[model samples]
Target chain A: MVKLTLNVVMAERNITSRELAAAIDITPANLSILKTGKAKAIRFSTLAKICKVLDCQPGDILKYIDD
Target chain B: MSKWLKFGINCVIVLGRISIVFAYLLIILPLGNFYPVIKGTLPKTILHNDNFLLLPGKHTVTAAAMQSFPSWPYAILILIGSIILIWAIIKHLKALIIILTNLRDADYFAVTTVGALKQLFIARIAMIIGDLFLASGNQLTRSWFYLVNNDGVMGATWSSAVADVWMAIFFGVIYVAYRYTLTLKAENDLTI
Candidate 1:
């Protein structure tokens, strides 16, 4: 199974959904969805956007967990 | 200014107004029509229609025929387009269901579904408009061809052109509606 720890990362960084969206140029609604991990696919550009905003790596936002 | 702040305020105001409107439109309005029913029984008919069955005009007939062509290529295109539209709609609806189901305690799945739903809605509307344009064009083409061949090619060419233009305009209105209903932003994730 694929596991995501976006909440942990967000909390650790004290990032707000609005701030993140502004930084990445996405709507907060869209950012909220991604944070909650409901997104089916993430674009590399969006990944870069998120990485840049959060000051983290792609691995920090998403990861694979054994089912 | 802030997206969340704006979203939060808009949602509250819109939802409150929507509820009030929903009450009037769905419940109050229906009950109000039953003044005698409140005292006796409801009206037998909800509408005051005279059972009119409207048949299409020449132009409308042409458009409808074009839209419903029996040609294999058109059939395949429509089938594929419909399937894609349905898929997008289903995905979005499923996302909404997830969110509603977990409102009190939303999980990642619920949140992600919201984003997915928005994207799907945009995509589905766009696809539908494209399909309509193609279908409309196909129909008008056939109509013009029949008009030219049967009724002396040059005699009614101008009239057929006018009809074609009207059909295009009608489809244009539908396209505009599809665009207006969508909430869109450039995707950061998607790059050329």
Candidate 2:
């Protein structure tokens, strides 16, 4: 299973979901979906935007968990 | 922003209401005139042959007569069917009004429009079933009195408005497709 570490990264950066969502020009609900690992898949463009906003690499925000 | 379309929808809504009232009046007025006759003939039973099997070249005809049955039960079934049809029509009209209103407001992709279309489809199915029931009731009543004509041919045939049923089913399929598209659009809209 693939898990999102967006919440951890956001926490380390001292950024709220609302602020991150606004910075990325995305809805807070969608950010919540990604943070909760409920997203089916993430677009590379969206990943790039999130990584740029949070000043992190894709690997820092995404993790592959063994089921 | 077509004025003609708005005018058309408004006219349909008004016409729908008028037709509903007219149908109710038709039912009520007839009941009023037939109440006394029906009361006087209350609980009346009738008996008649249901089938006549003609043996091949045997010069023998076997006729089976159904037992005496009260006419009121069939009458009540017809009345119930009529009421169901009326209710279905009203539901369809309401769904149409909602769809038109949503279209006018440029909310064509709203979930309420999908819900209304589903309701209209179900109501059409209900109306078709109701019509079938009414037709069966009519056939049953006719069979109670006469099943064969003077030409020795079956006279009381079970029949329904095939065109109406097919039309309803056709529109139901279209609505189902439209609803599916709306569902897809709604999901896409939420997929930020």
Which TM-score values does chain B get in all models? 0.32, 0.65
Task: Give one digit per residue, the lDDT tens place, for model 2 in B34-138.
Answer: 353376442122222233223234442223323343445556655666667767777877788788788777786777887887888788777767766666655
DockQ of 1: 0.08
The DockQ of each candidate is 0.08, 0.18
Q: Which ten residues in a row have the lowest lDDT in candidate 2 chain A?
A: A34-43
Query: In model 2, which regions exceed 4 Å deviation?
Result: A1-3, A14-41, A63-67, B23-74, B140-168
What are the per-residue Cα lDDT tens digits for candidate 2 across A13-59? 99998998999988888988888766767888889999999899999
* CAPRI category for model 2: incorrect
Best by lDDT: 2
C-alpha lDDT values of all predictions? 0.49, 0.66
**Per-residue lDDT of candidate 1, residues B1-192 (tens digit):** 466665665565455445544434432332342353344322122112232122244333344443343344433443443444344434444544444434423343343445544555464454454445345433433453232112121122334445545655554564455344332322323221
DockQ-based class of model 1: incorrect
Residue B105, model 1: lDDT of 39
Model 1, A1-67: lDDT tens digits are 5555777888899987777778889887777667676665677898887788788998998889887
